[model samples]
Target: MSIAEQFPYKIELHVHLDGAIRTETIVETAKRRNIHFPWETIEELKTHLVMSAPPYHLGALLEKFHTFMPVVAGDRDAIHQIAYEFCEDCKKHDVFYTEARYSPQLFANKMSDGSKPPYAHTEGDITPREVVNIICNAFEKGSQDFGVKVKSILCCVEHAPEWSNEVLELCKEFKPRGVVAIDIACGDLDPDVPHKELHTRAFQLAAQYGIHRTVHAGESGPAAGVRLALDEMHAERIGHGYKVVDDAELYERCRRENIHFEVCPLSSVKTGSVPDDLDKHPLHRFINDEVNFSINTDDPIVLDNDLTSDYEMVMKMGLDKEHVIATIFHAARSCFAPPEEKKQILAELVKVYGEKYMKM
Candidate 1:
């Protein structure tokens, strides 16, 4: 049987909202908005949007965003449609629950101070705060309509520390709505780049004010980045943390502390974060040592994968069906949903997969 057929229910914690936008949405939005997009058809656009080959570096994948983000950024209708469609896509992928993450500032055409936006072609009335509100509203409606629980994680761009404080505030304001966590996403995790003070302060305050934290570290960077995420950022989970295995002491510390590593098998290869050879994947150590981790698709649009694609990648890497089930439980336990909602999610998982898989 196929992995999706075997495990029809799943939980995903590390997918990016911007990275998962539908190609059709981009093409349509570009034409509707008169954005002068060069690619007219979905098939043609995907050749540029999707990373089917490599250099396979993180920077190359991020460059894919520049192609379509400008088309949708700063547009209210486009933002709402993507968030709503994301919920439907989640249900199609059998993702019962998900925490879709993105940088709200990237979606807005203008900053609160009347400055230009990052990805938009021109500045306009929409602010980062408004972007959050739109996504929250869309997610709430989409969840009810699609029968999939979707939450948002506001991201602090690694290169743009200036926006970190506002990202924190947005997380706080929308916590009761649909927002659940704060993450440091985007930009390359270059080891030489000095950690920004503003980013650190925001995360520290996030912890102080009880906002859940996750950081994208140790994917392409060194294991020290993972250590910094745990120490300074107080990350509850590490996103795409494949390199932690390189440092035995740090890896052991993570295992002892039960820090959840969001593993993305296809993405790791697509972005060249891991070796091209699946047999030499660090996930083998993670499985053998019984470290706490969960499988995920980091960027479906760019990597040309969904939840099932990631599951099949790992299954082909020698993981059994039981191992796949355990990761779903790990995601459930590590998700940023409120205690009551989390309980319901766990109960549903048990209902579908049974109590025995919980022990695996």
Candidate 2:
């Protein structure tokens, strides 16, 4: 096998739980629930789920999950199974450590307003807290079963002020139970229209309680979105911050603060957040500008990408072996895993990338 194939000791910081659903799980779960999906077979399901190349839509980013909501939004076992399979899939793909995220608001009784995640009726009686516990416990089982390290982060939707507060409370209550940090995700409006009042309150609680902050900014939104997330909510890490390269001041501040960028190259292209053309992607600029970043599969199965594929993509896009390796280390540092776990993964990375392991 080539070095790319043998590339060892991976870490991811930006994968979405719902966005990364396994097609087979989606198919089988839908079948059991009598829920209908557009495709009949796993092979056919991949056509709608995976983004082979770009010219993909932003609506397609989370909108593809409309068919998936019935299973996830309704059932605890379905959520647990999905979380377990996500870790299993990461281990099979050679990821040793990872931080996964999800928005809890989407699950709790979907709304009649403009709010998303249409409520899917469930025969089972389950609250969102129970749902969170089920998902977290399933991650623990998957870690034990697959020998991969996984941590969960909860997201509060940008526009859902009330739900955002509810999700933040969950983050505080579940911090010791494998939920590490809080995130505000999925606002793609212009930078000037800040989603502040409720998000700020939630983040203040995070600060008081020691929950780390990661935010989705500068994605489909402009570079100013990155600055707003920091200024308004104190974002410690940015998800899909390619637009930071477009603004010199933000670039300099990110470098000085050691703010990590969770760069999901494939998702960037597919969501129209960055260019469809890989060569034109600002990952090159992030490299040139010395911004801290970690390559990630924002949605693995959905985008037809995993950590290894992203490693190959970056290498082909002009990153050398050292940068390719550094990205993993960057993720290790920025990951929400415990300090000792972080140390172990870093040591393992050194051992694998070191001459001793390579020679062996």
Per-model C-alpha lDDT, please?
Answer: 0.90, 0.78
Residue by residue across 186-240, what tens digits does model 2's lDDT show?
6652455555677777887787788888888888878888887788777788888
CA lDDT for candidate 2: 0.78
Clashing pairs in 2: none
lDDT score for residue 183 of model 2: 87
Candidate number with greatest lDDT: 1
TM-score of 1: 0.98
By summed lDDT, which 10 consecutive residues of candidate 1 come out lowest? 187-196
Q: After best superposition, candidate 1 residue 265: deviation in angstroms?
A: 0.8
Q: If scored against the real structure, what TM-score would every candidate get? A: 0.98, 0.91
